[model samples]
Target chain A: MAELARLQADFAAAILGPDADVGGLGGRVEGDGIPAPLRLNVYRNNFRQGLGTALAEIFPVVQAFVGPAFLKAALRHFVVAYPPSEPMLYGYGAGFADFLDHFPPAAQVPYVADVARVEWAMHELQNAVEEGVLTTSALPEAGRVRLSGNVRLVVSRYPVASLWMAGTGQLPPEAVNPDAGGQTAAIVLSDMEIRLLPLEGGIKTLAETLWRDEEPDAAQLVHLPALAGRGMLTDGETQA
Target chain B: MPILKRTEASAGTEIGVGLKSQHYQDVVATSPALSFFEVHAENYMMKGGAHRRWLDAVSDRYALSLHGVGMSLGSVEGLDTAHVRRFRSLVDAYDPWLISEHLAWSRTGGTYLNDLLPLPLTTETFEILVANVSTLQDAIGRQVLVENPSAYLSFVDSHIPEVDFLAGLAERTGCGLLLDVNNVFVSASNMGWDARAYLDAVPASAVGEIHLAGHALKEVNGLPLRIDDHGSAVSEEVWDLFRHLIRRVGPRPTLVEWDTDIPALPILLAEAEKAAVILAGETGRRKAAHG
Candidate 1:
């Protein structure tokens, strides 16, 4: 039992990284039919399979992009790069995007990491409880700043949504003409549905007004040019 | 006709759900009409997190059960002590109402597959199983129910029947049977065997609980295969099987297990309610649990 524990810890550590001492389980443990390294090889395959399958579940975009065989190899690297901890398995591979950034083989695909971030966001969104959208009718006289985990985030990015679309099969591979592109405004929605709205020429300022938990009174000009010029409120009709 | 007369012994009071993170908050908050909640001990073999928090919260509310999927209780290589220690620590920490693992082997020579694989019912395998279960019971210091697994393939070398294997294991180690009814349907359909006869062979008193889950049917190499996906609702046939089972077993704590494509809480709760109804009507209600 003691020998097995030492071996298991060693095996786990070896899988973690090179700079680990798994009670000599890092090198070899000889046996018949399947020798020690051979056994470890099986563990390596199974470990990769388990973690890879998990990653596939979370990031179908990456899986679809790489296809099954390549995805398996890529996931083998991903697993070693990030072996999951227990209990918190749902959010286990949280650091995967960063890992994908530094990963040697995947370094060529700069977009892969960004794509992973979007998928991770989707994974989170699926589990996140829905909240009411920000509205101006119930405006607070005093504007306060808050950054709860449930805070609404509206991101205006250049081409990240396009990349996400292409990766997730929402926009088919051909529809995503790699040469043609455009930036989009997207809310990091936390719920059953997710949408990507391409930012119009004038949405930036409007988005900024309600970006925080504050009222739109001070930043009211961001929504209307006349209000900004007058330094006063605009009529409800002007919102349209 | 009733397969087995409803008895208080068969329909024990303790019923539980396999704890998943999705329902952690609800599990802690609104006290559901449940006798207990079971978590895969392997999932909580960590230091701390929501796993500890929610388990601690819900444990205070209801009886807890530590159901394990990784312990290769039927392994010929013998019990893994590190696994035992983790399970022991979990049991010591939670002090659950029930402790159990599968009557199957999933590892050999240190490469754990992490899936419960079935063992052929040979005399040799039986000896290994007996030794393994006894060792696990001795180490855990409690009688653990050995669960029947949903098998994909049947072995040619088997001598004893499924019920015989379970009964023998229980007899040898004084363990109980966590009879997963869905597994019986799956194995029977996959192997083209009679599920009823298999169910009839086992005495109701040996069973400790029942599991009802959905399975996916697939065609692998021109053969129909029923994979226990647990990703959907319980099938009509499986429901009928559960009815037959509870008619015999008489209102045991049956769990509605949906592991994938998990529907809303209302849907799952509704399914459990349906099972509760079946148990009440099928066998004369010894005790009525209000939802």
Candidate 2:
């Protein structure tokens, strides 16, 4: 058992570690005409290529904004630094947005990380279980409220919602301006479709307040009906 | 837990294909005449959304097979209980006719490499496999089939042959076998073994399902290496081996897997159709032999 554990640890290191260094693991693999290192490259390629492709699928918009070549290069680094902890690939890239934020090469595109954040949020919401929405008539007047399970709030300094729309072809690329200040958008799954609803005025304050689990002030209370109508607000009831 | 029973009447003629998200709408609209649809269990491990909805719609119309790619049954660290619980939930919800996972391990330490890594056929690994397979079967409350993996390299210290290892696993744990003909061909070509001899040695009665998929051929170190990419049509050699196995083992529930570079719905169905024809021929041969 100890020998098997050592063999696996060595194999994993050879694959996930630096290039061309198989250590003593190379001799453990059979060499039939093909060199051991060369054979080991097959698993290496599979690990990098397979995980890289899965990450690309999760952040297609980021790939589009950064170009496939750039995204592929960035992913080559991201995957090594942050491999998935679980087998479910859909929930794989939780740390990607954070990685891009600190990535030196990605620093050129300041808004790229925010875009990744949006994509990650949507990816998460898309897979989240649908919860019951409180009807506008059923809303409790002056009490605590919460965002639905399927809704995600992404408030970014960049106009990330428009950038995401352009990447997904919802808006023309020319219509989005990166320098157009900030945007607060609620990514909500309504009627089985994930919609990006931009929030402003009292509605934004109301959402931010409820999202923090703090009671909305009187000024933000006026927008309660609008939020409930969109199926974004839910009664503050803990899930059973 | 009532397993979806595969009756003797429907044994040989059923042909299924890998369920791809690209073909979800078309499948819902056309409802193709497939015996079942095999899904990668990890892909649908979500709590809810379009994937679950689509799978529900399709599973309503066809028998489903949950083919897991990430169980890491051969891992020395033992089974991930959380993963097994999630898999059990999926089984409880879908009640698939056939449940299968690979004979390879993909997770080591804590990180999941996302590719099926080969395990050395040593006594230690064999014991690990037996323990993990037993745990998985006990958790899911059903017989789970273990599929052969495509190998690019072999461990030098391993003395047990791959076929004997699988047969031993079945004997010890009462698990069934998913004989992947492409893997047999790929591993044979890469490891310098005879594909026919490998097939001849498999315990016929233990094979509950068969997988036929395409592989990509690449030259590594000036030597031919067959990668099980499943990106194209089923190779002629794999189809021939499929015929050879069924000629001896009789027909089992067969699936056509095309995971990468997925073509149109018709292309995948055509592959499944080809397998159906071959299976039907085998069934006819068996009938004649009995008569």
Candidate 3:
């Protein structure tokens, strides 16, 4: 009975990646007329396809940017490097953007990683808690006015969000500039819809500051109305 | 002693279809007279959103069953306390008629694969399941059902048959069983076991719910492997077994689960209707006998 856990660990290692000796566990299925390696492959296929499909769902525009073939090649390496931590797949690909950044083959498509970040932020904000817009009455008393739980500030050296919007058909294809300059986009839920609002210099700093729970300075506070006007602030609480 | 009160079990009759997000509007607008709608509990494991709002509206109109895929009940370590709490929150919010998790492990050492991986039917795994089931029921303050999994291959150390293993787990933990007929057929076919005998081994009263779903056939090393992909319509063989089991166990809350390549709501409901015909008769007789 005690040997079962060891076997599971060995088996999990075998199916999860190329590492771990399947020789011991694979031998067990040999007597069943199904070779142990073949049996192990079934789970290998299931995990790859199952987690791969999930990764694809979260980073669709990234898949679009790199093309399906390249994306799948990248996923094969990503799943093994960082297997899902939990079963709720909604937020599983949070690290995928980082994975793509270091992924060798993806270097050709330099903006692929940033594109993934935008998609991940959008995926998160889409399911994030919706809140009522903060009112003027609530602003003065609050020491730090936090953005909505769904607000995500994405700063990239490329116009990744625009490319994603164009790729997903949210914006006209002509609006997308693959070589466009760096930009900051705020992924937030507005009007019950996920929106990517392009942020300027000051607004970008304010968004980042508010997201980090720090008090925005006068320079950043001056941009609050612009952000507030866009319904980005959801909670206004005075900090001690 | 059970820590929580048991929500009344679904009379183990009637047929329900899984509520997919794609079909949420239809479910709300049409309000199909389904026996109930089963949803993946993890999908609704959120603070607030359209998902919960829509589900709240739907629950008011119909019965709900919370089928969880992420608890990893069969993990060696134990049930995740946080995950269980989240599940309990949903249960409290909806007061679902049935709640279930698989008898397979999806996590080991910390990595969660998100797929129901097979567990060896050993005394060791049995004890783990019993403890996890007990902990989950106590945490949720209600009895939860454990569903049998379809295995692609058998473990060499597996000393216990799947049926007796589940029955013993139930007897020890006081948890109910969610007998998935499709799983029985898939596992039986994959491992060369008699599907009918497997059904006979399960105590009828332990079954609180039934699941019928489609499976994909794959060939591994020249041998047939039935994968419980739940992609297409229920096959003719699974329907036959479902019919045989329903007669033996009487009516149970039957759910038509189409997780992949899910067709339209009407198509899924059509499949549920087929099971409804079989259930309608047996459920009527039971109601009359009780009255």
Top DockQ model: 2
Q: After superposing candidate 3 on the true structure, give the runs of residues whose Cα lies further than 4 Å from its correct spot.
A: A19-24, A136-144, A170-175, A208-220, A237-240, B3-9, B281-291
On TM-score, the candidate that comes out on top is: 2
Candidate 3 lDDT for residue B130: 84
| lDDT tens readout by residue for model 1, A1-240 | 343334334545544543322245534443223233433443444456656776777877766665677657776776676565332345567788788778777755656665666677666645454443333343334443222232233342325567667776677777654335435333344233554444444444454554544544554434444312212221222110
lDDT of 2 by residue, A71-148 (tens): 998998888888888999998888989999899999888898988888888888888777778879998856677788
> lDDT tens string, model 3, A1-240?
456667767767887766334655865553477766776777887888888877887888887667888888788788878888877777688898899888888778888788888888888866767777775455655466778765788888888668878878888978777688988888878766888788888888898788778888887788887888777887643211
* Candidate 1 lDDT tens digits, B108-180: 5555545565565767777777888777777767778778888665444466888898998777767788888
- lDDT per residue, candidate 3, B1-291, as tens digits? 654424344555667899888898999999887878999998888776677788988899988889999998888888888888889999888988888989998887788876788888888888888888888888888888899998887877788999999999888988889999999999899889999999988999888899999999987678788899999999999888887787677888899999889898899989999888878776666557777
**Could you give me the TM-score of model 2 versus the true structure?**
0.96
lDDT of 3 at A83: 88
Give Cα-based local distance difference scores for all models.
0.63, 0.88, 0.82
Model 3 residue A157 CA deviation (Å) reads 0.9
Task: Tell me the docking grade of candidate 3.
Answer: medium
Docking class of 2: high
